[model samples]
Target: MKPDTTAPLTFGMLVFDEVEVLDLGGPFEVFSTAGRLARTAADEPLLRVLTVAPTVRTVRARGGLTIVADHTLDEDPPFDVLVIPGGVTTAVERDEKVVDWLARRRRTSALTFSICTGAFLLAATGALDNRPATTHWEDQEELARRWPDVRLCTDVRWVDDGDIVTSAGISAGIDASLHVVARLFGEQLARRTARQMEYLWTDTRA
Candidate 1:
């Protein structure tokens, strides 16, 4: 893995008040590590990971962990991959501004991804319409009731529908990120990265 100077993949994390901290941090860890490790063997860094919120300020997490976003929604440039992590999933799903951003950003990004209850927000964007996806299993029934357009899958860590992808809760975010790594640097590299990170994920190849 070398510095891919041509087109750097921008990884954007969408944060809202009370967002689950783990969902936001998990994939960020994987991709940032991948970028650093790749840089070690290549010319330039491969990822630009940043946290984004309504405005760059301290937003409290679900359990009262405060974080400072790197940029506000309007200030941040476009991202190749936008990750929406679940917080108060229902609250996020019902937010008008969050829905609007996701809808607009989906048009620009190569990939839009969600973790845990974040799938609820993605479904709100109508991006997952007619596509198979999954979220935290606890939210499936409610999600199905609310967004009937998405086909829910029960037995996988993640479902990637080309432009849109969703994963199960918490640690499943690690699997989803590894899926991105697999796509970017090949499966072997992804596996190596997973091993180096000491992450556990579903082995679809098995």
Candidate 2:
């Protein structure tokens, strides 16, 4: 489905048990704050940010951070941008239902991206097949071993392959989110938002 570019981009970050807190929280901060900072004269935000979980409840994240999902998988609104964050993801990676949902999203969402080991879950849907992608440096070999069809790379902050983007672990998600903002809005707006977060945005690719 072709997206209406004029509409506010709705970003949904998928969260599961043991998800990396920084992976989800970092991008959430970037997109939500950037949307506020990038509002127009109409006062409509440029982006809408929310969390999606298998269920509508709090999930324990890595480092014991508890996060309540804004929407459940079946009740979420249409997502223009879907973010998959990574941590201890064996459960999500092996879930057939979740993989099917991701496959469907890949066909419809304007953009579908992943951070760190979340690439494993995305890869299970075959979305990353024969496409360049990156994950956390530590899991680079294992990801390649499991998803041989995917062109996995390392030493990169993120890989922006048009509709799909994958980034390195944790903090790298922030850079990738800013990159998305820059692509959709403008560099000036992304820079300003990064400044507000006191984060130095890096666009370097490997």
Candidate 3:
């Protein structure tokens, strides 16, 4: 199997059982299609996206859709960007292995992102300590109590706190990914990519 090597932008999206599909897939589409979107009378898609899961077998998402993992965490390469997807299971409050991986990768990645409840995983790594952040609205209360060091915002779609980024809910993940593309490439490119994905890109967070 060959990778979609059109844009040269490499992404690693962490997948596990019950991952919120859109949180991961949204960015994958935005980033992977960037090369095609950026194709300005000359360029095609230069982006390469790999779906990394805990296991190589197809893992079911929260919605019962089975997805084939392109790479396992063990085979994960050094991604230019790392995306952390959220699910209701993420709210269970403890998943040590994932927490550990985020802790390790956040230090090396160019960007670390979280969607909805996935911010809990980032917070577990102490990356957001004393930093401004926003997670799913429902978790704002407990998140504040559990991690008092983090300034949790209940009103934003996402928060870009330097090296780390956090999004509010499921669809907010879409907004976060577009913002990432804009920062890396340009607003024009991001808008182009969003249009291709049929995303409206209405982020009021900034």
lDDT of 3 by residue, 1-206 (tens): 12233435567777778888777777777788786665432365455577777646578888898889887766756777778888865533366766677688888887788887777777888988999988788878978998899988878888988778899888888888888877777788788888888878975684
Candidate 1: stretches off by over 4 Å: 1-5, 40-42
Stretches of candidate 2 above 4 Å error?
1-6
Candidate 2's TM-score = 0.94
Candidate 1, poorest ten consecutive residues by summed lDDT: 1-10
Off by over 4 Å in 3: 1-7, 39-44, 90-93
In the range 22-128, model 1's lDDT, one tens digit per residue, is: 89888888888777766523456667688888755679888899989888877856777888988796666676876898889878887788998999888888888
Candidate 3 similarity to native, TM-score: 0.86
Give per-residue CA lDDT, model 2, range 1-206, as digits (tens): 33244567788789999999898888889999988887655567878788878765689999998888887778856878888999999988777777888788778888898999989999999899999999999999999999999998888999999999999999999898888888877888889999999998886664
- TM-score of every prediction relative to native: 0.90, 0.94, 0.86
lDDT values, one for every candidate: 0.80, 0.86, 0.76
Show the colliding residue pairs in model 2.
none
RMSD of each predicted structure = 2.6, 2.0, 4.2
Q: Rank the candidates by lDDT, best first.
A: 2, 1, 3
Question: What are the per-model numbers of colliding residue pairs?
Answer: 0, 0, 9
Count clashing pairs, candidate 1. Answer: 0
